[model samples]
Target chain A: MRHLTDDEIQGYLDNHPDSDREKIRAHLDICGQCRSNLENYQIIAGQLNTDHIPALSPGFTDAVLSAIKPDTQDVPVEEPSRLIAWMSAAAVFILGIASTIYFTGSSVAKNIIALFSPANITEPSFVSRYKEYISGIDLDLTLVFAVALVLAVIALIDRMIKRRHKPVSFMI
Target chain B: MDDKTSIVRKIVAGDKRAFRLLVDEYQRLVNHIAFRMVSNPGDREDICQDIFMRVYQNLAGFRHDSRLSTWIARIAYNCCIDYLNKNNIPFIDEEFDETISNMPGGSITPEQQLYKSDISNLLQKEIGLLPVKFRAIITLYHLDEMSYAEIGDIMSMPEGTVKNYLFRARRLLRDRLMLKYGEEELRQ
Candidate 1:
């Protein structure tokens, strides 16, 4: 008795493979067990193909609607951390100023210390020679402030220039 | 309330009453989908509630570009997928054959088959066990009777992708039935 290979069976099931149909039929004719199993499988397939979508039970929708419609009494208070953001920003600005002062002070103090020991310097160490070349760390406070003031004035002037186009109401 | 635009108008006017009407009408459709996508009844209810709650919260952002039903359906679709992902369910890929070959077809009587089924019930179970997207896509297409274009719009899938999913979902079902039951059972 000839038997069908798994591939041949799958080909028939999928119905596309190049397996010769007569060969499969002949094998099926000879093989009782494959035929039986195939029959069982086909029956099960038919049973499953029935499209019976279940109906929604009574009040199912109402129950779901109830779950959705809760009493709106509990309000989640919005944690407005705007003040916290402002406070943190203010803290950083203060810290930035403090760090600038401390850094400048330390740089100047180091230069002063390096200069005081100049007698012991023949080929001045990089630190002392750097200080000798420039007593300060070359911080031009006036120029720096002047540029900052100019930027502020330019920004203010630009804002005023833009403001003139505003549709202002001549309310008495 | 069933008129989609009217519901939106009423809902926008701070009408809690309007919301209840929308929730009442659409909750079945939402729950039907949610229940099919996720097997747990409780989770289904939770997802349904969340969808309505979201409808309330994001009402302001909704433009009148689309019908309210479609918009709400899109939201419910998203909410179900989100719920599935958050719960660690895997998305189904159209990668493998799911048909079982050894189903008992001839041995069982047609009467037995009919008596044994609530096909939709078994269908929900099988569909739920599929890759999550398969279940959602199938439910959206079949139970909701949504057009491919509407399904695509709701899912944000390309129309082609939605069509492929619709085909894959049916193929998966056929394959699953083939594996569990045989070809004759299908034809019968």
Candidate 2:
């Protein structure tokens, strides 16, 4: 007689199929090796079933609870709308760029016009004004760059502070 | 509403007390999965925390289709898999013969044999040594008392595959036991 396959033996152990189970039972009764194998499988199954689950460490619930930040009230806090924030930021950036261009372009245009004016090109007074205009443009550019650098530094510091203050959910 | 639904609703409604209650209720279930999947005792707590945080963050999106426990379990299982993949831990599926040959061998003293707990402890250690998949299936099936279908849902595998894994895992454990303690000791 052919021996039962592992699947068949497992099915028999699980009581999966009625007919197949009966066939295995008959075979086990007649065959010592299969019977022993079946017993071995049964013991292992029993042990697997009986294995104990270790309990969570003491204060486990408290640890989890402590990690979570509790809402102050039942009502959810209304966060400032992100769309409004983005639109405001975009408006500020556009305004800054537009104002810089308008001021610099107007100054440059005035200097260029003054230089090309037939009478004013050689005038000492016009030359002084043109030099002043050039210096003013340089100063304006320097101020804009300084303001941008300061804003970037402030934003970076603000981000670092927020991250440092953010409550960590896990202990580690 | 069912208890689960009521609890979930309270949690989603910014009820910290309700969330605490939910955590208390499911801590063991999460711990069981995390502990079995992660061998390192130090990492288990962090993994459990991460799983619950994910659950809490996504609580608002939870539809009532599946049981809350199953949903949490799925999150836990995914977290475990992520931990394994992230750490580059090799979850090799060793063949039965290979596992048996590598099984730790030493005769149990007569005194040790007298205590059944030692045998059970050895069995558990061997279970822990099984591949990640096998450890997961064994824990979910036997310790958590989850059905094969639930395990399949959590692990994202077909039910048949779950059953096959379960069987193979158990057989590997059995073979390990036979090798470690001899067939005579196991038969008793």
* Top-DockQ candidate index: 2
Grade the docking of candidate 1.
incorrect
- Score each candidate by Cα lDDT: 0.60, 0.75
Look at candidate 2 and tell me the lDDT of residue B126.
74
Candidate 2 local lDDT, A1-172, one digit each (tens): 8998877887777666433766788899999988888889888777777747777778877777666664333434454446544544654674576465676876765676667866735667877798688768644555655665565555556557655655443222
Question: Which digits, one per residue and each the tens of the lDDT, describe model 1 over residues B104-141?
Answer: 23244565466334434444445655666666666666
In angstroms, give how far residue A106 of model 1 lies from its true place.
Answer: 59
Report model 2's TM-score to 2 decimal places.
Answer: 0.66
**How much DockQ does model 1 earn?**
0.05
Please compute DockQ, using alpha carbons, for every candidate against the native two-chain complex: 0.05, 0.27
- The reply for model 2, stretches above 4 Å from the true place, is A15-19, A29-32, A72-172, B92-99, B103-117
Stretches > 4 Å off in candidate 1: A1-172, B92-122
